[model samples]
Target: VGSAAVVFQAARLESVPDRVSTLPEVEIQLFRDAVVQVQEEMKEIKERMADVLPAEERALFDAYVMMLESETLIDATIQRIRDGNWAPGALRHTIEENARVFEQMEDPYLRERASDIRDLGERILARLQSSEQRRTGWPQRTILVGEEISATQLAEVPREALAGVVSATGTGSSHVAILARAMGIPTVMGVTDLPVERMEGREVIVDGYQGRIYLQPSERVREEYLRLYEEEQALSASLREHAAEPAVTPDGHAVPVLVNGGLIADLKPSYVEGADGVGLYRTEIPFMIRDRFPAEEEQYQLYRQVLEAFAPRPVTLRTLDVGGDKPLPYFRFEEDNPFLGWRGIRITLDHPEIFLTQIRAMLRASEGLDNLHILLPMVSSLNEVEESCRLIEQAWQELCDEGRRLVYPQVGVMIEVPAAVYLVPALARRVDFLSVGTNDLVQYLLAVDRNNAHVADLYDSFHPAVLQALAQIADGAHHAGKPVSICGELAAVPEAAILLLGLGFDSLSVSVAALPRLKQVIRGFPLERSRALASEVMQSESSAEIRDRLRQALIEQGLGGLIRAGLH
Candidate 1:
């Protein structure tokens, strides 16, 4: 394979400039004809791919085709213009403005979609102007560099056959990275702007563990990589031995290890790791992927599959936390700061039908399951909790009236909001459990935007304010005789795990990949020692000071390496 590493400072937008700057009468007529042609071609293509691709992939392709339908865009634009949503000459301007905002967003998914909008806008103008069509070709043996790839083109490459992916964008937690891991493909995205196309037909190597991409490696480099790969394989194989064992401390205290997952497909790894349960089930995925809300039957089918996949293992199914940063294209909403906008439980509450429908589906699907728990996200007030419970009750009554046997899952409220933390004593009394959503809790408490890379360092879970909130919530839950869990990324941190155990968390849920290291952390320190360390940590003035103190304590206890590797 050919490989090169020339940094792309900025993407060179290629299109026929001024092609649609002035639209004529003849051009508008041609645009309408083009729309008809594109629609016909799309219909024929879908029919041909019916048997070749899976239903999900087929649906994705259809959605892509729908996006390119000139009639749909024209109609949508016309409707908006008629409704006076945009002033005269603002349609293209609106799309361009939003596109730039998306480009600047930290999330790779949004950033890539921003570029997609730009492409879409041009196509709309082309349809309006009757511009000459451009031919598209394949980039075989070429490592395509972009922030993200089209969802329709996601499965184009055979998993093992593909060399590697080096995206100009993508976070470790993004869907693209998750898919790459599942496919067992070596991927190192977020590589600034490496010239991916030049790597075509060039011999190269990808080291995902070290996030490195070697271009035209010499014999020595190849040999070293082979040796390291073998070593890694051996190390991974060794982990299977402990897969069946309960994760316990040296003194024999059992710490339940669970996996965080969204799809039922993740259940295989959860079972293989001997996971106690699913810590977090992102229930918003199905809704976000679809063009519109799924039918009640369709929702039940998917939920039923997940309930059956884990069987007896507890699955904490969080309600749809859509809107804000994660807006569904099907639903239109405007907001200044999406992060602080209407989201999570608020969306569900406002749209009671949506909430009731999902609850009914989950309840019906969980007919024989005792481990299903419904978790509410972004809850801040007691009223929201009360209303959510009322909705659950209403759904239960409806299910009963219909003579459908259903098991109403336990309701848990995430204590992420500052107000929720303050009222945990009262909220704990109403809910079955309390799960501290530290990712948001820390972000909200410090008023720091987690997505802002420039201020990411300030977003620390170990902050004194964050710890104090955690302590309060956990203590309140304990007092109320309800279980408390930390489903946030902080629970995965080695040092943070010690504090969590000390602060009275019933369970510490983390990413599946972090389990082994967390297990090591558990074995290295006693519960009592961790409690003492926690007490000292809580008294520290600043998060930095607390981190330093924790490091010193870990080093004193001969766990510097573990802390450094997993925590820092």
Candidate 2:
């Protein structure tokens, strides 16, 4: 839950004009001038973002730049207007055509790009309208409401005045949501039922924690949220006081908390303030942002910066986890079931050259500071692990052959597939450690695609079977005398972190935003009590019961603030 807010700032675009017959020459010139003005404004925004935003976020503007620089866009617009079509209609057609291609894509990441196209198209269309048509002035404690809030739209709001954000489109993974989190603003996305047109200047309460919006809230409701808002502030301040403290239970069990990062921005003081280390550095992020594969030198520099930031603190880097939900724009492929198809180790192992280059860069980057830990993603068989190990060794040997001193990094396999759960004993015997990627593990175990909204409700990490699997994996890894850790969304939850602690996870790797609350939860809950709770939940037959039990546990401990509103 984040700070609750009153007053809505509706950010709607001007209505598009209807298509008309050939415009006068003056109208055409006006249209051209508007296009140039919007393009220049976009350029200025990009330049300003260079110093403030991360590389991945700055890349969000690349699509806008591409659209503005497209000769086809201008040429097509001019030709269409000359041939008896309206400028706004012509631009909308082009944007819709481009967006439709991505909208039809199965990958969630690529599909979200369609929103980017629409966002840019709206910006240009807004410029086409008269200045008087646009709304100005933001209210105090503004809850920015829109059909689809863009990164630039979010950027335009004053930080102090912006309390929350709500959108009718996009998911938590959208760029706007990502920026909101980075800025510590509460956000709710994909609110299909939100009455965007009527939300202007309305007194609304945004329950970001629960993804609920209150339209002209009752006085009782407003008072109660006001209480929550004050309590949240006090709790946040208290949590920050202990940010640098170790996550040790009152019963004396110490659990190291690490941050899962992908971008260079993850190295910011805010993110790393309380982080023990970088638990899972998504190497695919660098690859995903680029048009082509990043060279070895480029990879080396990036990895080295992360290594140097938390030197001596272990940083586990997952090697190229692409081809499924995350596909490279440059390296395209078609699959009936991409998630179940050749992804993760399958792709890297198939192309040893890509795998080897990455490994070599990782090894070389860890030259003096030996804090690098290599993690292999989506491993189901013994052969994949063995082959991957061979490639790592080959890379090490090649680097050493060049007379460069390096440390042979510890290797681990991500137990994401059901096959890997049963094979944990064999897998643990081979690798230095095991990391449970609960996100994919739960998806594969429950036979539910977490990304698909239709079945998303059924994707429960607390399912009885999933809990049992976690217990089994932990037992198997411990039996083999190997350390195990969890680095997934499950690890980020305070309740789940408590269960993971009981399940024998050596460390909990969560997002930077989740670190403080997780630490507070860990420090408040006793290890023995957590173990008993885990055992009790494992025996429970339903996920609802498990959640109730967990929620009750939080309330009993006076950590009820961590619970989402309405759950209490």
Which candidate number would show the highest TM-score if scored against the true structure?
2
lDDT of 1 by residue, 82-121 (tens): 4443211223544566578878999997788776666555
Over the stretch 387-413, how does candidate 2's per-residue lDDT look in tens digits? 999999999999999999988899999
TM-score of 2: 0.73
Model 1: which residue pairs collide?
1-201, 1-202, 1-203, 2-199, 2-201, 2-202, 3-199
> Model-by-model lDDT, in order?
0.67, 0.79
User: Which sections of candidate 1 miss by over 4 Å?
Assistant: 1-121, 124-145, 148-233, 269-273, 542-568
Worst 10 residues of 1 by lDDT: 9-18
Predict model 2's lDDT versus the native: 0.79
Q: Specify the poorest-scoring 10-residue window by lDDT in model 2.
A: 1-10
Among these predicted structures, which one has the highest lDDT?
2
lDDT at 375 for candidate 1?
Answer: 95
